[model samples]
Structure formats: C-alpha cells, structure tokens
Target: MEKVIEMKGITKVFPGTIANEDVDFDLLKGETHVLLGENGAGKTTLMNILYGLYQPEKGEVYVNGQLAKITNPNDAIKLGIGMVHQHFMLVNNFTVAENIVLGREPKKGLKIDINKAIKDVEEISKKYGFSIDPKAVIENISVGQQQKVEILKALYRGAQILILDEPTAVLTPQEIDELAVIIENLKKEGKSVILITHKLKEVMKMSNRVTIIRRGKVTGIVKTSETNIDQLAELMVGRKVNLVVDKEQAKLGKEILRVENLVAKDSRGLNVVDGVDITVNAGEIVGIAGVDGNGQSEFIEAITGLRKPESGKVVLSGKDIYGKSTREIIDSGLGHIPEDRHKRGLILKYSLFENGILGLQHKKPFSKGIVMDYKAIRKHCKKLIEEFDVRTPSDEVNASALSGGNQQKFIAAREISKDPELLIASQPTRGVDVGAIEYIHKRLVQERDNGKAVLLVSLELDEIMALSDRIAVMYDGKVVDILDRKDATEQKLGILMAGGSLSEAKREVKDVE
Candidate 1:
C-alpha cells in the first residue's frame, strides 16, 4: 500500500483547550481507514486540519509522499481531497445539478451552461454507481438521497481521497446497506476513503484499518481483521465498556399515558400521524419502532404539545392533556427529551446553568417571585453534570461549548432529575458514543425499575429490541402492532415497519416454515 496522506506531530489548540496534541495519522491509497473516537475527542478537529478548515499549531502534512502546505478548502480540493460534512450542505430549493456546480459551473463564452452542468453531474453519478436524479429538487428528496448528492458533489470535484463525517447518523437501516455497496464501488474505483464515525458496527463492516483516538492523541491503530467491537470500544473510551443492555423483566403497573385516535399533521398540512392508539404503563419501556418520517415525529409532537393534534385523546396520569400548552403538559408529569437536541433540548447561547433549568425556570427553588436564584441554579447544574458524567470545565460556559454527547448527557440529566411520571425520550442516544450509550441505557432502565413509564422513540432497532419491554411498530402514522419483547424479532419488526400488518408478518413466517 502507498501512503496517500500523512500528518506528523500534528497539534491544534483552541483558546483555552488543546484539541489535538502530537497526533500522527496516515491513510493508504485505495483503502478505507476509520477514525473512531468519542465526541470532542479531537477526531473532527484532526480532519478539519487535513481539509484546511483549520490551520494546525504545529505539524507537517504530506500528500503523495510530497510535503503539502494546504491552507484552505480550495487548496485541499486542488490536491484531490474532498470532505462531506455530517450536516449536508445543500440548498433545499435548488436542483441537484445546480447545487453540485454552484461555484464552478461549466460556461459557454459569456453565459452559464446549465445543460453542460446537468450532463456532467449525470455522468459522474453513473460512474460512481449512484442513482440520483440531477434535476430533482433537494428538499423533495429523501435524506439518504440528499447524502448521495453530497458524495456526488465531492466526486464531481475530482476527489481522490474522500472524508465522510458521521455519514450514517441520520440514515435508515436499508440506506446504510445501500451506502455499503456504494463504498465498495468507490473502493473498486481505487479511491482512498477516510471515514469518521462513532458506529462500531459500521466501522468493522466498512473499514480495512481502524485508528482509535482518545482525548487528543492516537491510542492505537489496528487492522480491522484483528480487532473486535469490544476492543475498539475500550480503546476509544479508555476503559472496559458494556455494549449490551442489562435489565430485569418489567413489573407492569397502571397506565401512565394513553393516546387514542391521535391525528396530527406536518407543516405541509397533511395528516402524517393518523389515528395512533397506544398506552405506556408505570413500570415499563414502550418503544416505538419505525423508519424516520413515517409519522413518528408528528406522533410525538401531538402528545408533547409541541404541535397541536388535529383530533385525538392524549391522557397523562388519568388527566386528558389534549389542548394543553407545552409548559402545562410538562407540569402535568411529563418529561420530554426531544429528538433534535439543538432545536428543542437546549439554548446554545445560554450558560449551562441556565439551560439546566430551561422549562422549570419559573418554578420554585430556581425562581422566587419572578427573580431567579442564581445560587440554586448553579448548584443544580453542577449536580446534573457530576451525576451524569458530562465532561465540562465549568457551569459558567455556554451549552455549545460541550460536544454533542456531553450536551445530550446534560439534557438527560436535567430531564431525569425532574422525576416526571411519564418520560418521553426521543432518539435519546442518536449520535452518542458507545460509552455514553451504555450510560443512557442504564438510566432509562433504572427509571423503569423506579416505577416510571418510559416512552422511547428510536430508529435504532438494536436499541428498541434491547431496551423495550414491549415494542410498538409504527407505519404511516399508525401502530401496526405492539409485540412483547420475547415475541419480537428484527425480521418481524422490519416487515411491520414496511407497512405490513401483524397478520401478514405471521403468515410470511408460516409460509417460510
């Protein structure tokens, strides 16, 4: 193997923190190398340096065995290096071809050549085994398709070395498999790839070599054929980790939440959540399993009062909370961990102490007659951080200062501290590392054992299967089937999630038998 990218003695520092220190990383030609680490462990910082987004404090970069002085993205692109961010940078209303060739468009004499742009995009899509419509609008496409467009953008720019950051964070299971095929195709074309992700399963399945980074330095670099998930996890977290969820059987109690004939609409005025009926008991976790955009978001919104239901019954703790305000709903014994932590969970600009008491700002101990007790608030925030293991310097810093995983842990700590009777945790561990995932899972189970009703909504089937006492499969805004944990399998859940009825799923199994 030939060395394509090499960084020696790389050290990047922020104002008060060392993001990366003396990190040595290398990638070989035509091989997929994985950069695995916990959030804020300097994985993205290191890649940013390579992509010329950030200049390193000290280090040397070599491309094709020649020293390179890349200072910006344009310089990196000129060197055949392209990066696709975790968040897709695409214009929603523009056509795929337009977005791909926005800056560097093919022109004819004096005017933009739109036809040539589309033709070039189409040709590149075909070369990479991608099935993308260059003329389709970005907003109208699925998330998976949008991701392909991001990759195509990089490929169209003549990227020989591609860096993908958390590529599967928002994709469905089927889309993940499809992406695997695409990666194989890219490898067949003899392109080197650097994958930055926290998914151990995907790391093992896709990469030829794994480089583990802990804190700000490389801990170990091993061949994928030799390392298991456990070894990789331990290397990243600096300790032995429990990858499996451990919990005893639930002891069911009275119903804590009940939703009957729940109907809700999306921003487009269409009934996305149509007539959902379900119940969560006091001492159990009832997980809703479905692909994203299958009415799950709307369903959760309808119950949480984030969006008003068109028509439905949302009863919480024997009281109908149907038309209540979000605050009233929260006061009515409901603790909600929203899916989008950035959008709904925390105020990025506010101090951690302030975000800690977000919804409860006007209530007792935190506030006295409209005047907040800063002392109490700081104490509460400190306790949440210490109890939840949210790694941070101080409560005085803004919420944005923490990494995604630490922010998530802060939110979970605040919500669980409320001690609500019915806790609605939506995508609780979506982008968290394995160690954080383990801690979060244990907390959810502890809540169940403490006689609280937990309503878990997640797209991760492994999570649904591992954490739920009963699994409820949702399809097109309806509860297709609710199965006991002992009776549910990934195959059966997949069948139901794809809009097949419970009877149809059973019949298919019988046919196979």
Candidate 2:
C-alpha cells in the first residue's frame, strides 16, 4: 500500500494541557483508515495537527512520503487533504450546488456559471452515488443530505484524503447503514477516507485499519480483520472493558407513572402526541422507541412538563402533573435527562459545578436562603465527576470546554443524583463513545434496580432491547404498541415503529404491566 501521509513525532500543546504527545500516524492512498479513542483522547488534536489547525511543537509531516510543512487549512487543502467537521458548515439559504462549489465556482465571462456548477455537482453526486439534489436548498434537506453536500464540497476541491469527524453521531440508524454503503462506494472509487469516531462497532465494521489512542499516545494499530472489539477497547482504555451491559432480571413493582389519553399538540395545533396511554412501573424501564420526529419529542416534553398536554393526564406518583412547571415536576420526584444538553440540560458558559447544581440549587446543602453555597456546589460536582468517571481535567472547568461524552456524563451524573422516584432518561448515550455508553447503561440499570421507575426514550432499537423491560413503539402521534424485551424482535419493532401492528407483543406487555 502507498502511504499518502505520515505524521511522525507529532506533539501539540495548549494552555495547561498537552493535547497530543509524540504521536505517529499514517494514512494510505486508498484505505478507509479509522482514528479510535475515547472522548478527549487527543484524536481531534492529532487530526487538527494534520490539517494545519495547530502547529506541532516538535514533529514532521509527510505527503506522499515527501516532507511537508502545513501552516494553515489552505496549505493542507493544497496537499490534497480535506476535512468535514462533525457539524456541517453550510449556508442554509444557499442551494446544495452553491454550497458545494462556493469557492471554486465555475464562471463564464466574469459571471458565476450557476448552470455549469449545478451540472458539475449533479455529475459528481451521481458518480459518487451520494444521491443529493443539487438544486435543493440546504435548509430544507435532512442532515444526511447536507452531509452529501459537504462531501461534494471536498470532492469539488480535488481532495483524495478525506476526513470525517463523528459524521454519524446525529444520524438515524437507517441513515448510518446508508452512510456505510456510501463509504464502501467511495472506497470502490479509490478514494481514501479517514473516519474519526468513538463508536467501536462502526470502526470494527468500516475501517481497513484502526489506530487506538489514549492519553495523548498511540496505544496500538491493528488491521480491522485481526482485531476484535474487545482488543480495540482495551487498547483505547489502557485496561480491559466489558462491551455488553451486565444486569440481572428486574424486580418490577407497582406503576409509578401513568399516562391516560395523552393528547399533546405542537405550536401549529397539530396533534403530535394523540391519545397515547402508557405506564412505567417501579424498578423497571419502559422505553418509547421511534424515529426522530414521530411524536417522541412532544411526548417526552409533555411528560417532563416542558409542554403541557392539550387534554390528558401525566400522573406521576398518583398525581396529575400535566400543568405543572418543570421545576414543580422535578420537585415532584421526576429526574429528566433532556435530549439536547446545550439547549435544555445546562448553561454552557457556567462552570461544571454551577451547571450541576442548577436544578437542585435551592435544596439544602446547595443553597441557603436564596444564596447559593459555592463550596457545597463545588463539592457536589467534584463528587459526581469522580463517581461518574467524567474525563474533565477538573470539576471547575467550563462545561463548554469538555468533549461530547464528558458533557453527556455531566448531565447523567446530575440527573441520577436527584434520586427521584420517577426518572425520565431520554437518549442517555447519544453522541457518546462505546465505553461511555456501557457505563451510562450500567448507571441507568442501577437506578432501576434501586426501585426507581424509569421512562426511557431512545431512537436506538438495540438500546431499547438491551435495557428496557418493556418497549413502547411510538409512531405518527400514537402509542402503536408496547412489548416485552423477551418477545420483541427487530423486525417486528421496525414494522410497529412505522405504524404497523405488534399484536402478540402488545398482549405480553399488557399482561406484565
């Protein structure tokens, strides 16, 4: 195999931290190589050094086995390196073709050749099998489609070594499978790809070679065929890890959360959650499974008191909580792990200690007569950070500075700390690494075992099957069916999620509940 690029003796430092330390990495000419590490494990720093965002203190870079000095992004691009960030950088008002050919637009006699650019974009889309509509505006397209536009941008700029950073974190499972196929197609066209992700499963299945990094050092590099998931995990963590969640049979008790004829509407007066009824019993987890937009958000919002139901009852602990404020619901023994951490979970600018005590600040040991006790708050955050294994340099750090998984763990630690009777854990492991996913799952199940009622909502069916005692399939503004984990197959659950029937599965859930 021909080496396209080699990063030898790479060392990068920031204020109070060494981001990358004496790292050696290589990318082949036509291979889908993977960068595997836990959150804050120097993966992004190493790639940024490669792409010229950071100047290494002591290192050398090579392009096609020739030494090169990349001082900026433009220099990296000139060396046939293009990177697509986890968040898409595109003008929403611009058309897909326009976004793709923004800088390198085709022009005719001092005028932008709009038609030619569209034609070129369409050709590239078809050639790469990306299936993007060049004329569609970026704001109107799905995340998956917008990603195609980003790839098209790289392709238009004549990039051979493409870097994708956590590209599938926000995509649906079906979309992830489609992305895998597209990657295969890219490889078939002889384009080398470098995927930076923490999901071990994707790395195991997609990459030809995997490089594991931990604590600013290269732990190991192994061929994908020769490395099992366990080996990769151990190398990444510097210790052995159990990939599967371990839990015994749940000893479920009486219903702690009951929903009767739940009807909720969006701002447009559309019935997003219509006539749904469900129950979550003590010491058990009942997961609501669905795609991204099919009433799941509204259902959780209504139940958690973010939005009041149009006409229904969200009975928590035998009391109607439909019209209560979020704070009141929290006071009423509901621990909600919101889906969007930045939007609803925390104030990003605040320190981790402050954010951890936001919802519980008024309680004793956190506050005293409208004055927050700073020492107590710091103590709380420090304890949870150590207990939850959040990979922050310190608990006093700003919440925004942490990585995705660390932010997630911060939220998880706070929610579980509430020690509420009924917990609403929504998408607890989304955007986290596989190791962190296993850890979070263990924590949630431990909560369940402590005799708490857990109402879990997730888009991952595998997660629903793994953790939930019973699964409620939500589709098109209704509770289509609920089923036990023992009898629910992926095939049946998929059909029910798309508004099909799960008759036998429903019978078992009803009997158990």
Candidate 3:
C-alpha cells in the first residue's frame, strides 16, 4: 500500500503552551489510522493543522508522496480531505439533504436546485451504504443517521481521506459495531481513514497502525496487534496507568431521595413524565435506563429543581423541595450533572478556576461574608483537576480550551467532588473517553459506598448496569420496572423499556438471575 498522507515534525504554539511538537503521523492508502492520546495531548492539534484549522509553526505535509500545502479548510477539501468534527455542524431547520450539500449545493440556473440536490445526496448515500433520509430534517433524525449524512457530505465532495472525530461517542453499542463495519467497507472501497479517538479498544480492534501522543509530542507508533492497552496507556501518560478502578461492595442505607406519584410536563403541557414513583437509598446507586427523550430529562429536571412537577411530590431527605428555587435546591444539598455540557455545565468564556466554582463556591470554605476567597477557589480547582485528571495547560486557561473529554471530567469532578447526600447524575459520562468513563464510574460508585444516595440516568445500558445497585427502566414517563442488579438482564430491560409491566419484567429479570 502507498502512503496517502504524511505529517512530520508538526509544532503548534499558543500563548503559553506548545500544543504539538515534533508530531509525526502517516496515513496509508485504504487504511484506517487511529490517533491515541490523553485529553490534553496534541492529537487534535495535529489534526487541526492537517485540516488547516491551525497553521503549524513548523511541519511538512505530504499527499500521495508529493509535498502538499493546506492553508485553510477549503484547501484541505480541495485536496480530497474531509473531517467530521467532534461537535456536529448541521443546522436545525435544514433538511438532511440541505445539510449535506450546505457548502456545495447543486445549482439550477441561478439558485440551489432542491430536487437535484436531494437526488444527488440520496445517490451518494446509497453508494456508501448509508440509509439516510434526505428529506428528513436534521433535528428529526437519529444521531447515527446524522453522522452518515456527515460522511455522505465528505464523499459527495470527492474526499478520498475521511477523518472521523469521535464518531461513536454518542452511539449505542449496536451502532458502534455498525459503524465499525461501515469503516471496513469504506477501507475496502479504497478510501483512507483517520480515526481520532481516546478509545483503546477501538484502536486495538479497528486500526492497522496506532500513534500515541502525549503533551505535544509523539510518544510512540506501533502496529495495533503488537501492543496491549496498558502499554499504550503508559505511552500516552508517561506512567503505569491502572485502567481498572478498585472499589468494595456498597452498603445500602435508608431512603434519601423519594418521589411519590411525580407528574411532570414540559412547557407545552405534554405529560413527558407521567405518574412516576421511585426511591434512592443512602449508600446506594439507582440508575434510570431508557432511550433518549423517554422522560429522563423531565425526571432529572423535576428532581434537580430545574423544573417543577405539575402534580405529585418530590421529597429530598424527607423535605418537599419540589417548588424550591434552583439556588434553594442547591442549598438543600443536591448536585446535578446535566447532560448538555455547553448549555448547562460550563461557562466557556470563564477561566477553569472560575468555572469550577460557578454553582457551589458561595458555600462555606469557598466564600466568606461578602467576598469570594479567590485563592482558596483556585486551590480547590487545582486539586479537582489533578484528582479528576482534567487536562488543561493551567487553571488560568479558559474552560473552553479543554478538550471535550476533559470538559466532561470537569463537570463530573464538580458535581461528584461535593460528596453530597444525594447526587443526580444524568448522562454523566457522555462525551468522555473510555479511560475517564472508568474513572468517573469508580467515583460514582465510591459515593454510593460512602452512604450517599445517587440517582443516575444514562442512555448507555452497560453503564447503568455496571454502576447501579438497582436499575429502574423508564418508558413513556414512568419507571416501568425496578430490578435488582443481581436479577436484571439486558433482554428484560429492553422489554420493560418498551413499556412492559413490572410483573412481566420481574419474570424476565428472574430468568437472568
């Protein structure tokens, strides 16, 4: 196989940080090359340079054995390279076809020809084995399908090199497997690929050659089959990494979070959350398992004081905090890990130190009387960054400078570090890398073992099962059934997820037992 692309000695410097230094990367024709690194490593920076998002201070790029110069995204695309970013770039109101052909639309006489564009996108999708609905609105399609549209867009632009950035971050296990097949198909069809991810399993399973980056330098490059995950971790972090977290069994305590006939609705007055009753005991973890939009949002909102239930009661530590203000609820000792990081978890413009104290800094030991203890706040944030492994150049750096995985860790560290009596963690590990997921899982479970109540809601069933002392399957706004960890099965949970009765669920749960 011939080398399709090569970048050597790439170095990118910011105000006070060298994001990449002497980074070497190569992509073979019709091969999937995986990039592996820790959160703050220079992997993304190197890719950004390749795609023209950054102008490397010193580097040389080769395409098809010929030296190439890519100064902008347009230049990269012109050279048959396309990238699907970590955050999607589709417009909400645009149809799938519209989004796919956004920058390069088919013209009919003077304007975009809608009919021709849809047909072209559909044809390209079929050629790529992507069953995307071209006419469907971007907001109306599944994340997986939207990703296919992104791929189709690249293929439509005649890109021979496809760069997928965390493509499976939001996908289910089934979807991840499906995407792996798609990647294989793309490679078989002679399309070169660059998969940027922190997932060691994917690197070992999918890529031919793997490159490890750490702190702005190339740590090592090796054949996928020649190295184990532990070796890769050491290369990425410069130390022996304990991939698995160790924790003892939990000791379940009295009920700390109690909900009785909770009926909550969105602003549209739709009963998104129907009559639901659930309880979480101190020193226990209760996981809510459901598909997206199955009342998980409403349930969390009602519990976290973001939204008030229309009917029924919510008691936190035996007190009705249902109608309490958001501040009041925080004062009552409930920590919430919201699903949307940008919208709920971070103020990107603020420094990492300040963003760490957004919600709870006013409390004792952080603020005194009328002024904030700024030095104390910085110290606390530094400890959290170290403990949670949040990657950043410094605490003075803006939170937005942190990568997606590190941003998620910041949120998890902030919400979980408090060690509150009751914690509501929704999609707590979303967008985080696999290594960090293991870390966050250990911490959440540790909280449970320490006699704190935890209400965890996640779309990942594996996570729910792994951490939950008890699993509550929610469907159509209610917990269809709650099963013991010892007795729950994926098959039974799937049935209950579709609105089966608890008796039926219990029977299925016992079958697994």
lDDT of 1: 0.92
Candidate with top TM-score is: 1
Show the colliding residue pairs in model 2: none
Scored against the true structure, residue 166 in model 1 reaches a CA lDDT of 85
lDDT of 2: 0.87
Tell me the tens digit of each residue's lDDT in model 3 across 292-378.
667888888887778887888888887778868888787777888888888888999999999888778778778898899899899
What are the models' TM-scores? 0.96, 0.91, 0.91
The deviation in Å at residue 421 for candidate 2 is: 2.0
lDDT-based ranking, best first? 1, 2, 3
Cα RMSD (Å) per model? 1.6, 3.6, 2.7
What C-alpha lDDT do the candidate models reach, one value each?
0.92, 0.87, 0.84
Weakest 10 consecutive residues of candidate 1 by summed lDDT: 12-21
Question: How do the residues 130-221 of candidate 2 rate in per-residue lDDT, one tens digit apiece?
Answer: 88888999886877788878888998898888999888776778878888988888888788899999878889878999988897889899
> What C-alpha lDDT does candidate 3 achieve relative to the native structure?
0.84
Top-lDDT candidate index: 1
CA shift at 74, candidate 3, in angstroms?
A: 0.4
User: Where in model 3 is the C-alpha error above 4 Å?
Assistant: 228-231, 238-245, 266-270, 364-370, 494-513
